[model samples]
Structures are given as structure tokens and as C-alpha cells.
Target: MLRRSGLQALQALLELARHGQQWSSVSAIATAQELPAPMLEQLLLQLRRAELVESRRGRQGGYRLSRAPEAIPVAEVLDAVGAPLQLSEGPAEGSDGRAETQVLQSMGQRLQNAIERELKQLTLQELLFDLESWKEYLSNEGGLMLG
Candidate 1:
């Protein structure tokens, strides 16, 4: 349930990680991921401010990861982009105070907590690894079917 900007930020970071310390222009990442360049540019600036990404200015200058991908957690990226992990807010004011409402609110809070915990544990490197594995699996399956 990530906002578009949050998803774009993750995609941009993954692209940077794939390049392995190489500088990547906004246009390059935008084109590769089919994202809007202007939006991506702003997201990178936010990431830079968050200290998750480093940028340089020059002919060969662009953006790169500020630290190793393994050090950057998915929750950190979402937070940097202002995307809250919680899907909904707590109970509304002036409620009937029924047991059902209380139960539902408690369950919702528990779910949000679990999601936050998982996102914190997931690193950018792990995301990249999963993406690579999925691609490889699809390619292998395609080849087998064709052969």
C-alpha cells in the first residue's frame, strides 16, 4: 500500500544498487524504471537530505547510495519519502466505545506494528536479491517452456 512516490524511491535505490557505485542520472533511472523524471529528481533530493543517497554535480555526476544497500532498510526509505507504513489511523473520537470497535482497533494496531517490524528488517540489498531471483526464475521457466 505504498504511495507512488515511495515506490519510485525504492525503485530508484534498487537501480542505483544494481549499478554498483556508479553515478546515475535522473533521466537514466527515470527511463529505466519508466518513472517521471521530475518526480524522481525530487525523491532523490529527499533521499539525499535523509542521508540515504549522495549526489554530485558535473558531466559524470549524478546520484549514488550513501552507504551499502545492506545498511539501508526499506522502512527508512519509506520514512524518508514521507510514506507512513500504517494503513489507517486509530479509532475515531466520540465513538460508541463498543467492545467490537475496541477489538478491531487493537487488531489494526497489531497489524500495523507487524508490517513496520517486517519493513525495518528488510534491507535494500535483500529487495534487490529478491528481484534478481524472480527475474532469473521467470527466464528459466520461459526457456524451459520454449525448449
Candidate 2:
């Protein structure tokens, strides 16, 4: 599961991409996505630092994707927002401490690797293309609750 901030960051970028090359203000994105403006602004800052989005200043100031959405991978967005696949830390203190821990760690590693591989293959463009399904699911199922 992604943290709330991570989801917001992704949404913010999606909004930017949806506009093509046009800049989207933080307020516009926040309103469109129903996310908090301040928080979205913060998330955009992180994305800017990661070079995923570029900002303009002055009256028409806002943000636009730094490059084409197809060039930005899902993993890059997640990494930019510090949302990586999470895994169990391992058993507390069971029968086989070292062995059990190793097994758990191994399993976590495999899962993480698989997730990373999949994410690498998915780009913001693909994600945006599938946005309609996501919105429908979210509306029908009350959406995913980000931590």
C-alpha cells in the first residue's frame, strides 16, 4: 500500500500529464483530485527535486511535467515520493531465530524484486491511460485508503 503522500504525489503528476504540456497549478490539481492544496504543493516540491516536474514563476506560474510521461516510470515516481515496497521485518523471537529471519527476509526480498520489476515496466503514461478504470474502481469501492 502506498502512503497518502505518495498517492497524492502520483495524482499530482497525473494531473500535470493529463494537461500535456500545459502547466497545472497546485490549486487546480488539488481541486481536481480532491487533495489538499498545501500537501500537494509539498509533494510537487519533492517531484521537482527529483526532476520529474518543472515549475514556472509569476502570474501564470505552476508546474508541468519535466518530460514526456512515457519517459517517467512508476518506480521513479514512487522513489521520488519515498514510497517503496514494504516487507515484514521478520519474526520477533521464535524457534529458529536466524533461520526464520533469513527465510522471512528472503521472501520479502523476492516480493520486493517482483514489485520493482513490474513497476519498472509501468510508466506514468500507462498509468494515466488506465486512470479511468482506477477512478471507477475507487468510486465504486470507496477507493483505496492510503496510510
Candidate 3:
């Protein structure tokens, strides 16, 4: 969550899937996203191991998604990159007085669930288009509903 690599991987994969259509060198992706090269390398390694992405070697060598963006759920990437939520095991003091802690834990779980739902359904193509559209809107109107 703090690292942002999980989301970054999703964006990278989706962008490559949508636009690359062939090979997308990591350097290009890193430059485009303005992400650190070393970090990108590490993330790409993790994605490769998770089978979410595959790489080619040589001049035309680069990386691409192993499966369709729609097929690769954001939840899957989150799991592959990091645990859903940083949930510690429930307290050992299982008692009625622990209701407050339980409530907090439940709330956390709910938040994680909501995030997972959004990520799982959001395809790479959709995200890319949304970003491009938002940029255009911001540039043109400078605000959502300019008066």
C-alpha cells in the first residue's frame, strides 16, 4: 500500500496491454510513469514470478502481460505484490470487552474488501483511458464544471 508498486504494476501492465501491443521496455515504462528504475526492476521481477507478466530478450525484448488485462484482477496483483490488508491476528483476549477492537478490525476488513472489489474489476485499458480523458478534461476546462 505505502510502496505504491502494486498500483504501479497494475498501471504499467494495463498501459502496455492497451498500447504496447508488442514489447514495452522497462526503461520506457519507468520514464513514462516517472518511477524509479530500480524500483521498477524489482516490481517487474515480482510480477514475472507471479506469472502476471512475461518478458522477451533481445533488441525487441521487453515485457507484456501474460494474460488479458481484464482477466488479471487487481486483487490478484495485490496478493501477488502484497497482502490485502496489514491485518494482524485478532487479539488473544477473546471477550465481550474486546468489542471495540473487533469493530475496528471489521472496519478495516470492509475497507480492504471495497478496495479489492474496485481493483479486481478495473481493467488496464479502462484505467489508461480514464487517465487520458482526465488529463484532457483538466487541460481544456481546468475544472470539472467550469463556470
Candidate maximizing lDDT: 1
In candidate 2, the residue pairs with backbone N, CA or C atoms under 3 Å apart (3 or more residues apart, or in different chains) clash, namely none
Model 2, residue 93: C-alpha shift (Å): 11
Residue pairs clashing, model 1: none
lDDT of each structure?
Answer: 0.90, 0.84, 0.72
- lDDT by residue (84-147, candidate 2, tens digit) is 6555555654547677677777777788788889988888988887885567667856765332
**What is the TM-score (0 to 1) of candidate 2?**
0.81
Between prediction 1 and prediction 2, which has the larger TM-score?
A: 1
Q: How do the residues 1-147 of candidate 1 rate in per-residue lDDT, one tens digit apiece? A: 788888999999999999988999999999999999999999999999999999999999999999999999999999999985666676673277798888887788789899999999999999998878766668846522221
Model 3, residue 40: distance off in Å is 0.7
What are the per-residue Cα lDDT tens digits for candidate 3 across 106-138? 777787678667867866656666676677677
Model 1 error, position 81 (Å): 0.8
Q: Point out the worst 10-residue segment of candidate 2 by lDDT.
A: 86-95
Q: Is candidate 1 or candidate 3 better by TM-score?
A: 1
